[model samples]
Target: MSTVEVILQSCLSKPAGNSLLVEQYVSDTASGRRYLLGRNEHAAEIMQMIEVDGIIDDFATNGTTWNNKPVLTTEQLPDQSMVVNCAMCIAPVSAARRLQKHGAIEILSLAELCSHLPQRFKLPWFVSQTRDEIRNHLSAWNSLSTALVDKQSQQTLNDLLHFRLSGDYHYMSGYSVRPEEQYFEPFIEPSAAHVFVDGGGYDGDTTEQFCHRYPGYRQVYLFEPTPTNLANARRRLKHQRNITFIAQGLSDQQGSLPFDTEAGSASAVDPQSSQQIQVTTLDQAVSEPISFIKMDLEGWELQALQGARIHIQDDRPSLAIAVYHQAADFRRIFDYVTGLYPDYQVYLRHYTEGWSETIMYFIPANIKQN
Candidate 1:
């Protein structure tokens, strides 16, 4: 059976919580022999739920303490230590290999360690719903595979599917770090008349890249709902000409919705947050003809797409939408875009070594396919 099929079957046949990998590791390890790899928010979460001797971070000072745990590099990792990888942004297998090379005995990914934990502890994109969603939408997934314009895109889709289903970072071993070149693919031809829209423009990094790429662009609209992020974007792109900053979230409709401000770039419309931000549809927000739109609104891409249907149908702007936030988005976003304009040539690219930063590009039919 294929890797995707094998993983799907495995998830379908076996129930979760059957094997508590974290418990097993703890039971097998002696006192003070446990370590966690990486010292990010993920590591903090893991530390709250379990005990560890120290946190391993190559960049941190050897004697410093992170979350009150001793910070040590892989070079200082004790012999026969059991390490749990908490670096969600990078490939777990690569981290494991590094730890092993440094004399560490055992390594487990955050996903594998938390696989038996409650659903609340599951990481984004690696949640329990992933397998069932893929299984239910098998036909849609197949259609998306056929819709991709290149073999690399098809392989990326397959690899991502396998990784999400199995929580095996080995599938992402071939991925490289190229987040800077994300929205600006070689397939897209730059034009001086390009009018760009930066949806979810956090800190103006993407807008800066766009300005750098298309220096003579006529106009640029940057939308960021978070107050701090909007201020940062403005400060960063203050000198750029013909730029409009809209401090509102993008959605299918106009209104206010609760938003979580503390999550930084991952912030979105969360009903749980006491803070609320105004939202507007792209069609209503911009009256000018748009040549391109790049959206990375966490998991709200679909809703924003629905709101921008008019612009997509009329302007047919080249689209670069993030699809890694949710598993169903792999097929849902492609289907939605093509459903609106059947001639859009679709392409997929992943930036990180993990499940994040998967972008689905939609180049209009008028643009010559490369």
Candidate 2:
């Protein structure tokens, strides 16, 4: 008999709704791996009467089995006709789209299971933004959880997550694009006249937001590696005279690096690609006391940090580093900053749905941040 049959046989007397289990994240090094192990066992029991067939995940681990059943990858999910999709809370939009294409009857997660299930399974953590108790509970997932942030910042993260997941921002702060993210963060001021650097300045949308937030910056250095993006950014910022444009990649070193251009605004230097782009270190590019930096280098955040180490250490500019490219980045980026600038306190903010666009904000704890 197939694995699906066995699961169905085990639930012979249960309700007959079909189910598909999707593990949104599976990390081999972090707690995610262990959580995956538990989810593997939990997949069979929906905490509801719905019948479960098999498990699916995009993490795509090899040579792994759950309850002696082969844990299927996202690619393998369609083969088994599934009805309900029990996915990670706030899975990427792409994944949801793929599952929709496959005709998943319903998409649910641990946090949402209670809403669908007859009884709430004693899940480790449930998510609820409407209630501070649940929000505060799950906010402890990291040192930079929502519970630790200011009430406004906490509301901002929760509201952004809600909008990302459900297309609703009723609870969000007025600012959709957080140019000066820590605007709610007190006692922090822009250093000097403000030498703002916009990494991956696609079409200058962020630049526009930055200007709107604080129009008095001395100079704005905009970097867009692609010919296409640079042209559009130039057109967008044509009237803005205080801006300098660089048509190259930013990296940890001042040298050429390979890049994948097909990814659009997320394009970055790739060592294996045949393509090449001029790349430079921010430290090598500028000598002034830096004030604010905003980087969305796709997956090159860490390398870019290495490039700006001196500026960050000496000038102590307010940092907004993107840390969602790789799961390791979530922790590694924070560690890198804290190791270099121990005086700085690290906080995290997540934007976008699924598992993308999580920004880590590092501010000097010496300031009055309540």
Candidate 3:
């Protein structure tokens, strides 16, 4: 039976809707057997019963079972209720507590978790709602027993959003772009304080897109380190009087380092990849006010953010950062950025509608004033 089913069965013998006392029996690599004693009122309720305040222990002293009997000794349970010793049954509960401790598992906040959410989620509000829903539904699955399933579902959601936003799908136009994202009327306009910073100006695809839709952008700054990409960006934007191209990669440190170019998207200034290149610091770039920044610099996001401390603090511009390159991208980047700028209203969005692209949006709390 499923872990939830067994837990519910164990609690249903007496009460059907209150918390019940539940203990666990677990084995360790060093200790032959061990017991995890605790009280979980919430889990008990989820298991369909209320746990009375009582001591529950797992005393499986014997090393093995006998006559098809469990080796662990335990206090007598309520009459008509069988002892629950299934490792699979209690595994999920154990994991749930651990994930909660690490601050990695939780249902979305009530306001964030709206009702009647669209199942076939798309961009803008739909994207935010879908992720919040997944986190809420799978909060219990973040533990070891169901971690694999939880991770797989997370990946699938990431991919679905990526594919929808990559701007390659034929159906992209049919989804009804957000008013802020529309090419005109409501699209982001350029201002004297506005300077577009492209962290990974790969052949200036972003530049071309920006210029095509919002060419009046006050000043365009492209950061491309690859010889091929740098040359292309230079050729493409050379005629634009407001555009400036930099042949450097931003990193945590302000020094040159090797970058793995072979992995392509996996390229890094560290040993994580095969190709290598010298890196620069964002501090070395423009000192003027920047209105918007788009980062697609592989997995060097943390280090890049560090180097841009001055820019972020001084400019306080809008950010569209790619977070798919690293495993803990969501937690690390989101917490770090938002923690530093508490007043900024951070919005998560995936522009790539594919398997592993997750782009996040960061705007000052007063972004709507613009």
Candidate 4:
């Protein structure tokens, strides 16, 4: 059987009682010390679910405390202590190795500890919705595997699928850590006359990188909706020349929508949010020819792309769009962009070791493809 079919079969079967094993471990180690390997937003929630002796953070100094529990460096952790990793942003395998080197007898990721818990803790790109979407769009998923431009991208898709399906970090062991080079692929030659657009510009980090990489770029149009984030972006890019900051979110249509600002980087268009923010379509926002466009909107990429149909059809701007927001995006975004301009070469690159930061690059046929 093909790898995809084998994965489908495994997913179709009932998942093993891994949560039960976690429960048994916790019960057996009640008298022993239990430490959380890393600290993140979910650390407190994990503590609430299970008993934790202390928190271990590599960056924390002496006498620091998180959730009233002492925070110790990995070197300070007692030998043979059981640890549950709470750092969702880092690679699980790397985190496990670090703890093991520091004398952790057993380790469990936050995902494993709360795998059977409420859905909110499941994290992005691997939620139940993603699994359902994959099951429903198996044909699209299969097509995506073969549609990728290079062998590495296909392997990335395969590894990510296995990791998502099994919740096993072992599949990510081969992924290289290269978030600093995201959105700017080596194959994409930097030009002096590049007109860049930074959609969902948060703190002007990506724009800053663009300025450094393309020093003589013509202009930059950064679109950010959140007032605080927009202010920060403006402050960060104040010295940069030929830059315009648009304090509005990108979407299919122009209007105001409820937004949630509490989630920080994950803040997005949440209908349940009481706060509202203005949004506009890319077609209506920019009329000039754009050479490159990078979008990392939380989950509003498709709608924004729909709004930029005219620019995409006319200018054929190089695109670095985040497809990791939703599972169907692995196929849906590829379909939408290819449908708009069939000649565009498609490529996929993942920044993080985990499921986040998967960008789908759409380079116009006019650009050199390596």
Candidate 5:
């Protein structure tokens, strides 16, 4: 296809109707980059792509820290009240809420930021489905979006898609989801004790939440590949006996591949890294029955589902797969899962501030019969 066909000029962010949103952006941008909140390497890329004029004020260093810019730690953060939230993937929700309690205005989102910049997210990746794979992927999204059962589910899916295709957070207005709620979505009654597969089990946070939410689980399979992370998860759930720590990553195949970003919980299978790690398909690795599966495997949700096809087809376990890791995943994983088990009730829930933790739940129609 030609470049003109690939480019989505029609869907680009317009600046005419969004004057109210970027009133602060015009004034504040002149002084300097007041506060760029993105902390990871992604934030670094944003900084590099578009020059950040001022300090990168972020104390919470979970992943790889910034190098080029002057990073102000905790003490200096008090002085810098964030006038503009420059596309922080996960907004500082708690702090924003706290400030709101004391009568501060709500923070801006990527959509609000889009009013100032030339772009919101990546260009026309959605409409550029000229290739067979992309065409199929787009078809899956359209199919699932239409056949989504509930109106709310469909809207949520669209809203998340809107944010992904264009970095707009309008759909996220007046919504807050607790972490416990992320795994245990409403509308479906979860059995008190059930077999659980916790994919991308980072530092036992979800495991701890799962224990509280569904106490006395029959069994739990916690999958984490990085050595340091596995050790951390082990240490966190050391006292628990029902927990089974699988020291490998999940994918469509069972073999070794180079894992990326081995720094704590952010590690995932990436081509850039040469560090080799063992990865196995769920069908080949898991022997017992699975009642529920929650995958947040970076961007490998679809591939993992393919590996676990046999299990899903047989057991029809409730799924809480992360779809916000990439745009197509929203449809690809959901389509495949529901296609495997047609009677499942689907629900969309956004766990984080933006499109990061948008989890798609698929519960079997006869879940109570389990």
Candidate 6:
């Protein structure tokens, strides 16, 4: 297990009376970068996972703190201060309760540092082109989005419109999943035996929902590399008879790979990154009837899918993939899937309003012949 994993296991193994929730994020500044730690009941868990004083002291020693930027550390955080972002939303305070009360953060530009936060997350992103830049990008995206939108496209638009208006139909409430059956149901019905390969299964929520709804499935296999996520997935599915959880990650090759980030967040084995883990391909590791596959790998969707080419061609399972990670991923994944199985009907939908896009795939009732 990785260092983070060990700490997470220790956290989860604690007594039931203990309730803790800790979150970490990156705080970038002109001088340097520092880690932001947030805690509720589980402040101790955060302490166990990180070198608290060390990390804080590093930033302090570098003189990165006490900046004009709006970030709240353990010492510097204000009780009710606001943090602004220049990219997605305006007045994006580091609190969700505030976000729910207020909708849409104002978009600011790098040049408008005086107007908004001085810097935006300068990471490689799919929708990096600001809202102002969308018009220029639309022309390039036209062909790709057009191709991805199938017959259900119109209905999806209608549903999305309704959802935006009233947060119904397309949205889910709590643990209860709203059943509109947009496009993923067709492929799941007829399979005599089914196996679901959940690549980025977090806390096993999706897998639990799948098993709860479809209890007769052969097995649900989960590949979560992070020790925290993997342990939680195991704990969640411990009572289930038809589930197998693995600590290894699914990648294009077989070897130890860095996860690149903290546990339970975005993980990768791209060699160039920091945190990594052992990798294995689906074809080499799996030996069952994989009827459905769901991938939410931060940006490694293509690599993970490519590793499952044999399964994609042979099983042709329904896919729930996050296509908003990379700009070309929408087109790239569509082309890759359709190129192998031309008859498979593709249906796309963006589940959340912001963040990223969740695209779904539905195979035709039967294989189409040329």
Candidate number with greatest lDDT: 1
**TM-score of candidate 6 on Cα atoms, chains taken together:** 0.59
Worst 10-residue stretch by lDDT in candidate 3?
107-116
lDDT at residue 239 of model 4 (Cα atoms): 93
Q: In model 6, how large is the Cα lDDT of residue 310?
A: 93
For all candidates, the clash counts are 0, 4, 28, 0, 0, 14
lDDT of 6 at 212: 68
Q: Which portions of model 1 show Cα errors greater than 4 Å?
A: 1-7, 10-24, 39-51, 59-69, 91-94, 110-127, 367-370
Model 2: residues with Cα > 4 Å off, grouped in runs = 1-193, 366-370
Clash pairs for candidate 4: none
Q: After superposition, how far is residue 221 of candidate 1 from its true place, in Å?
A: 0.7
Model 5, position 311, has a per-residue lDDT of: 89
Q: Residues 22-110, candidate 1, lDDT per residue (tens digit)?
A: 56765664567888888777778767766778988888865899888899888888787878777666556567678879754677766
- Candidate 5 lDDT by residue in tens digits, 1-370: 3222222232343432355655554455555534555454445544555555433344444333455555553334444344334433555454344434534333454345544554542222322222223344554555666666787876676555544444544445545645667767666556624888999998888988888777767889998888788888899988776998998989999998788845676677788898988989988888987888889888888989999999899878888888866666766777788789888888887766665677888878865525
* lDDT, each prediction: 0.81, 0.57, 0.48, 0.78, 0.65, 0.50
Per-residue accuracy of model 6 over 59-132 as CA lDDT, tens digit each? 24334532232233334433322222212211112222232333322211112221122143221122233222
Model 4 lDDT per residue over 305-330, tens place? 99999999888888999998777787
- Model 5 RMSD in angstroms: 5.8
Candidates ranked by lDDT: 1, 4, 5, 2, 6, 3
lDDT of 5 at 286: 82
User: Which lDDT tens digits does candidate 2 get at residues 1-370?
Assistant: 4322232233322332222233322111232121211243235555233334445565758756665555666555543243233443244344455655656334444433332232544232212222233233232333434223465545445444443222222222243333344222333464522778898887888887777666677888988888888899999988886899998777899878888877777677677789888888899887777877878898888988899999888877777778756545655677687778777755566554434566777776554311
| Better-scoring candidate (TM-score), 3 or 6 | 6
Q: Lowest summed-lDDT stretch of 10 residues in model 2?
A: 26-35
**Residue pairs of candidate 2 with colliding backbone atoms:** 91-354, 92-354, 258-270, 259-270
